[model samples]
Each structure stands twice: as structure tokens, then as C-alpha cells.
Target: MKKQHSRPNILVVNDDGITAPGIKNLIEAVKELGNVVVVAPDGPQSGMGHAITIGKPMRFNKVDLYEGVEMYKCSGTPVDCVKLAVNKIFKGKKPDLCVSGINHGLNNSINVIYSGTMSAAVEGAIEGIPSIGFSLDDYAEEADFSHCLKYVKSIAQQVLDNGLPQATLLNVNFPKGNGIKGIKICRQANAKWAEEFDERQDPYGRPYYWLTGVFQNNDKGEDTDVWALDHGYVSVVPVQFDLTAHHAIPLLNSWTFND
Candidate 1:
């Protein structure tokens, strides 16, 4: 751990490229809270879950997109941006905080498995940093983020003041519009995507496919993130990177081995 500074060093990252409106709003929400440094993908990289660039040279360039902000565009995945920020920019000193997204679309429930926004936050947790990922329900480029800024600042301030539990970060999702009820601490909903691939032929008669899917939420519990978002409350779920199924481990231990 590095020496604590009077003003915390905050690292901001996202999957929606470096120029998206979501990131700008996120920067705005936290700019006054700390010294912010942004490192994000050069273009939209949504659904890129915890992906990293390997066996290829990745590009990193500093650009002055936001006035008075230190921003860099990376030609790699969102996870790569975090790695680069920690390795090259911070020089092995982890930031006081790491926040990902203000994503244009929701990353609740099963969507977190495929979200680059959440993955970036997960990467921060893996590095032993207190991190959080933020997302809005709307997917439009011009989605209004005014309602989210206040909650963003409040939650971020809380995280900064009181560090998160071990091996955990937050996955926060907000409902669209100005009628937010409140924030709720919730669990990830039981949900998944029912997928279909539309096949078509190219000009040369070669086959191609377009992935499409409908999000299906089977969990009906009111204590879930899905329920919170549906009812106009911002959902904050504590997320951890450990994939081990501890419950199953005990059952497996009880099985007889006759090999």
C-alpha cells in the first residue's frame, strides 16, 4: 500500500471507449473528489469480459479530450487499460480507488459475466484496490445522467471513507429518468440471455452470423438487483472475483470415490 494522500488518487476506466458520454459524466461526478486519471479503450468494447491483449503489441496514447483531465486512450480491452494504468502509469503503486463505467447500458444479474465495465472493476479488486462499477439502464448515447451523478458521488464517497470488504467490489446499476427512489444493497438476480444466431450469406455466398438475444430474468425475489432496478431504486451489489462454488464443494466431498 502506498502512503495515504490528503486527496485520494482515483482511477477511472470504462468499456464504452474514451469519448462516450457515460465516461464524461462519470468523470464529472468524481472530478472534485480526487485526482482522477482515465485509461479506457479507444472504441466501444462492451461485453468484453475480463479480456486482455496478448501476443500483440497494444497501443496507448494520451489525448486531451476532457479539459483539465489526464486521459489516455488504449487500443486494448478495458482490463488491459487497468493493467496498463497500474503497471506503466502508476508504476506499481495502486490508486486509492478504481471506478469503472457509468456504462450506457445495464450490467446487472448475468450481464455482469460479459460486461467489460464490471470486469475492469473486478481487475481492480484482484489488485487489492477498493473499486466499483457503475451502469445505467439506458443504452442511448445521449442518455441523461443528471440523476445518477448525485448517487455516484455519494456511493463513491462512502467507499472512499470506508473501504470495502476483502476480495470484493461493487456492481451498481441505476434506473433511467429523474424519479430514482433510493439506493438498495442487493444481490445479483438470477438471470440469463436467451440467445439466437441469425445466419446470412455474404456476397461470395459465405455464411455469417449475427448474435442476438433477449435478457431473461427468472429470479423474482424483491431483494435482487433486477427487482431494485425495475422498481426505480438504484441497485448496489457487492461483487467478488472468487468463482469457487463452496456449497458444491461440501457435497462433492461427501461423494464416494471408488476409482
Candidate 2:
């Protein structure tokens, strides 16, 4: 970690391409906090969870956007951006922080499973770096991000000051309205999408399907990230990359498999 007085190196990334306004606002919010380096996808990579380029080669190009900030656009997924940022840009030197998103839409609850924004942060956590992913409840292209700035700065500063737990990163979501409550540290809500596919015939007489779904929040707990965002509060959920079902180990150990 850099000294308290020294500016720390921060790696900024996103699922929405580098030019997305959400990322621009994020840069504006956290730029003064550290020396910012941006590495993001060249195009939207939403719903691409933890995907990396393997079959084909991946490439990146330096961009002149975001004046005074070193930015690069990568032809890969959000996870790929993080990998390239660490291996190519930083040259194996892990940054002080890795922040992804200020995403175009909410990444609360079940959305985290498919969110490229959160995946970038997850990649950072895998690399043993303190990371965060921010999102707003609104999905509009021109969603107002005015209320999110202060919270972003606060959370980023806090993470910089007191690092996150081992192998964990944060998934933060902001409410849409202007009547903002306070920030809340909460758990991931038990929720999922009830999906359906709409089939239609095209002009060429071919059928295509569009996936759609309704979010179902079955968890009634008020301490969950979903509840926090629903009640006009900014929700912060600590996410872990470990997929071990440790709780089931004891039950499995009691089972007899000898035939």
C-alpha cells in the first residue's frame, strides 16, 4: 500500500465502454483521491460474467479520452480488462485499488451473477486487490448520476484507508430518486429472475428469441442489499469469489457411500 500521504495508484474499469457517462462520472468522483488509470472494454459487455478471451487474441489501444488520465480500450470482456490492466498496463505491479462500474443499471441481488461490472471487481479480488463495483438502480442511457458521486468518493476513500477482507470485494447499488437516504452495508438478497423467451418471426421468415425476466425478491430481510436499495438507501454488499458450499460439508461427511 502507498503511504497515507502519497497518492495511491487506482485502476478504473467498467462493463459499459470507456466513453460511457457512468464511468466518466466515476472518474470525476475519484480522480482526486489517487492517480487513476483506466482500462475498460471497447464496447458494452453487460451480463458477461467473469468471461475472458481464450480462443482468439485480445488487444488494447490507448485512448485520448479522459484528459490527464491514462485510459485504454480493450477488445475483450470486463474480466479481460482487469487482466490486461494488471499484466500489461501495470506490468504485474498490483494497483492500490481496482474499481469497476458506476454501471448503467442495477447489479443488486441476482443481477451480480451475470454482471460484467461486478465480474471485473471479482477479478480484482482474485488478484488480491481491494475492489469495488458501483451501480445505479436506473437503467436509462442518460441516468442522472449526481447523487452517486459523494457516496462513491466516500466508499472508495474508506476502502483505500481500511482495506477490504481477504478475497472479497464490494457490490454497491444506488437508488434512482433524488430523496437519498444513507448508505447501508448489507448482504446479497435471495432473489432471481423468472425468465421467459419471446419468439418472433423476422422479415426473412426466421425465428428469433429475446430473453426477458422479472426480478423476484423472496427474501423478506430488511438487511439485504435489495431492501436497502428499495428503501432509498445505497446498498453495499461484500461479495466473495469462493464458490465452496462449506455449510454442506458436514452433511456430506455423515453420508455413507461404501457399497
The residue pairs that clash in candidate 1, if any, are none
> What would the per-residue lDDT of candidate 1 be over residues 82-192, giving only the tens digit for each residue?
999999899988888999999999999999989999999999999988999999999999999999999999998888888899999999999999999999999999999
The true-structure Cα RMSD of candidate 1 reads 1.7
Off by over 4 Å in 1: 1-5, 257-259
Instruction: Please give the lDDT score for candidate 1.
Output: 0.94
Q: Per-residue CA lDDT of candidate 2, range 1-259, in tens?
A: 4435678899999999898999999999999999999999999999999899999998899999967999999999999999999999899889999999999999999889899999999999999889999999878889999999999999999999988889999999999968988999999999999999999999999999999999998999999999998899999999998999999999999999987
Clashing pairs in 2: none
Q: For each candidate, what is the lDDT? A: 0.94, 0.93
